[model samples]
Target: MGNALRFLYGQCCSEPPTTTTTYGGAGDQQLGHHGVSSTSVGVSALAQHLYHFEITSQVPEGLSKHVSSSKKAQSNWYKKLSKAWRESKPPPKTPEEASRLVIRTLQRHQRPDIEVDARAVADGDTVTVYVSTSDAPESSRVPQEVHMAAVERNEARAHKNYTKADALQKQIKDAGYGVLHINNEEILARKYRIRLRGIDAPESAMPYGKEAKDELVKIIDGKCLKILIFDEDQYGRFVGDIYCNGIFVQELMLKKGLAWHYTAYDKRPELEKWEKSARAKRIGLWASSNPEMPWEWRKNRREHR
Candidate 1:
């Protein structure tokens, strides 16, 4: 069951992901070739079979026929398909619904689809979840197994159970998300997707990347950040402008030379000035005699692979 869930949540994404998004601004800057496509995995057929999605939509009768497989036609078809999917059904609105959608991602060519019965139990290293093609009436409540875990965590806190709280926190993190403590008042857990805006941090495997991430962690590891979401990216991450204790996150990263100014998407002159100062001062990655940009690195990596 654990393996099943893992596959559903992760394994089906085998394709080289790409997303071409043009940033609309004064110059109509094309995005850096670094964007990722949607995170939802699996083929359209498999996904539809598992999620009850339909591919056919009223894309004008002869709209596709006249195009003859041209690039422009492909783009139009993609937009039409995306629009159809959006208009067909609303996105998952609750945690349980979202989880169900994720679990259905497990259906692929190599694996059989499982039924969702809203029953899952976890004992030691063993986890058992009932699967059926026919879903039971959608339950507003979290699955019993997950709910029990949440209850245990709450009970631990009530008794000042540091050991239990710490353990449960690890468990939650292992399951793909983190726990948030609210003003020392309540335990909060929810799915979230926040991408720091106006700058791109180096991947952890790159030079000074760990330092950049570590600095971010230092700034807000145990605190809530003020986030203003501007939009959602194709990958479903929130394109958010974040602040730490009133300090703009992008500005600070620029000052430290920990991130790129993300000129492809943002064109603020102040940000460019900060990047210039960091470069002149030879701080962080700028200290390197020659540092490779993350976008270029990713591009090269993909090409070589």
Candidate 2:
């Protein structure tokens, strides 16, 4: 009995019993021996037990699939959402992109289409972007009208119709205006006197003073001129240069010795040459042995008064 018990114990504890039957007792007892025991199971049964425990204690297949699918859908949704958000934002820092945005906004406003050269815009200032239609009318070009009038006068003078030309001159003088004839078709007239650059013609008729005025009238009587208005003088006359078809009227008068320049008001440094030429030629007031500058003559007259 002791030996039999030891054999049964060895069969159960050894690697595995290779034999199909064990020497227990007989038919019923043999059935008992064949019954299932913990140590006597096959490899398939052991694998099934491990699989069952894993299913119960660990994660399920259905739950893991659902979780992975949810994560993937969330990642895709976030990518699309970020892309849509970026579309409405301001442009990047590049100059070309920024300029395009500015120009588009400006075009929406009704402003002038003046080509803006490259410039930096300040913060908070309103920028102009559109074309404007409020420009001066074509028929209202003042300079062009003056030029045409000058041409008509010149044509009259050229045909030796002195009466008509003289009448025009008188009309111009009476109107407190000067005429500029530009080319044969353009004339300009303004009801103002531009101080002749480099020379001052006297207001009253002194010796050679009327002659100076007459010379100026002859040269610019019916010409078109560009008047650049500077400041006004104490006498309320606008002091500026008269450009006849772009020629400086003052330079021509000075070259002809028709006028003497007032040095205090004439800023041209080159007038010294003209002065020398005038003195050498004995022109205008220079003909007198003691010719007085208009300012000095006025000062002396004031003192005598």
TM-score of every model versus the real structure: 0.43, 0.38
lDDT of 2 at 266: 68
Backbone clash count for every predicted candidate, in the order shown: 3, 20
Highest lDDT, which number?
1
- lDDT tens digits, residues 204-274, model 2? 44666666666665555444455555667776556666665677767666666656666887667666677
Which lDDT tens digits does candidate 1 get at residues 6-120? 3322432232223344556856644322221123323322233222212443233222222112223233333433343344345443334434554543222111112111121
- Residue 138, candidate 1: C-alpha displacement in angstroms: 20
